[model samples]
Target: MTLYTFFGCLLTAYGPILSIFFLFIAKNAQHVLLTVASIAIQELFRWLYFLLMQRAEPGLNMVTKYPRSPFNRIIFAFVAGYGYALTTSLVSYVPILVESLGPGILMVPSFPAASTFFDAAVTTSFFSLLHMAWMVIAFDGFAAKKWVGSLKIGWVLASHLGASYSTLLNTSTIPFGCIYAMVIQIVFLLISVAIIVASLAKKR
Candidate 1:
């Protein structure tokens, strides 16, 4: 069962979301139980940024000579997310990814499907997208007059937690866990992208 799952994820990492790795990991999952700690700390900074942006909006009028663009929020969100994702990638995942280009294909003991370099790459691919997704959803919620305790924030945290722990599956099942991790991350991405598209069409 676990073996099939690992192969399924190996194909997925090399196939469906490979572009994501090129964009994010080449341009950022499971780091032990610390995945939990990392997600919490990362979201803490995002929430703090949201609060600061909220308070600064009133005084932002001082610099307004032209209309304040709604896209400004998105720009800031993406920038913050990109930086957060990049920083983590550089310090953690990039080390493993360095060997991705080599001819040698390293596998786990008794697990041929668990390619360490590529599995790490697959898991890393989801971080940048997830960061942007969570921020976009949370930021939009704030703009929509939604409370921090509302469904929007709830979804962000729930998805974040899900994606984080999904990698834990790898500890026991090897590559299957990484596959589970990406699937969860991709689900959150679709939801966030839909919300963003809707917001873009909405009248200010």
Candidate 2:
């Protein structure tokens, strides 16, 4: 039971991530490279990485954020998507995920059918998927040079804030707190999916 719980939570957390990468990124060489660099460069030369990205500001920045070709669009999206998903937010969770490898399964009282690890795993997967959507909408604004005035990106930002706030309810003190958090994230994720699909439709 203990090992089952551990692996169950482990797969729950990373399964979606693996699936998405395989479906969308693995086949694309550029995507695979960017994903690797996104995490690797940052870890290897933390200071130099930011310094260089800033230094590459003129050429690389414009190509990434205000890309002209369909290719550049993919470039920017990958940068933003992987950047947001694989950054500090991911690193911070690694240590805590050790909880998923437990001596016993820990259930959430307020949401008894779900274990705490499972709840956390679901939240993690949702964030990763949402980050992908966010990049698409955000790229629309950036490429259009409507950074401050883009309603689409603004909506994504607002949803992120609201989702973060809702996570506070992931506690026993609040009845159905975990349930509320899960529902909130699911709703946001659906909206994100719509945004991604809409963007893809526009491309087609």
Using lDDT, give the best candidate's number.
2
Deviating ranges (above 4 Å) for candidate 1 = 1-41, 57-66, 98-105, 108-111, 146-149, 174-177
For model 2, how does the per-residue alpha-carbon lDDT over 1-204 read when each residue is reduced to its tens digit? 366766776677777777767887777665676566656543234334434444554565453434455445535465546655666446645655786675666777777777777787777777776766666565564445444427775766788788878777876577788889889988988887786677667766
User: What lDDT does each candidate get?
Assistant: 0.59, 0.65
| Per-residue accuracy of model 1 over 131-184 as CA lDDT, tens digit each | 666776777676666463377778878888887886666555454555566677
lDDT of 1 at 31: 18
RMSD in Å for all candidates: 8.8, 5.2
Worst 10 residues of 1 by lDDT: 28-37
lDDT for 18 in candidate 2 is 72
Q: TM-scores across all candidates?
A: 0.65, 0.74
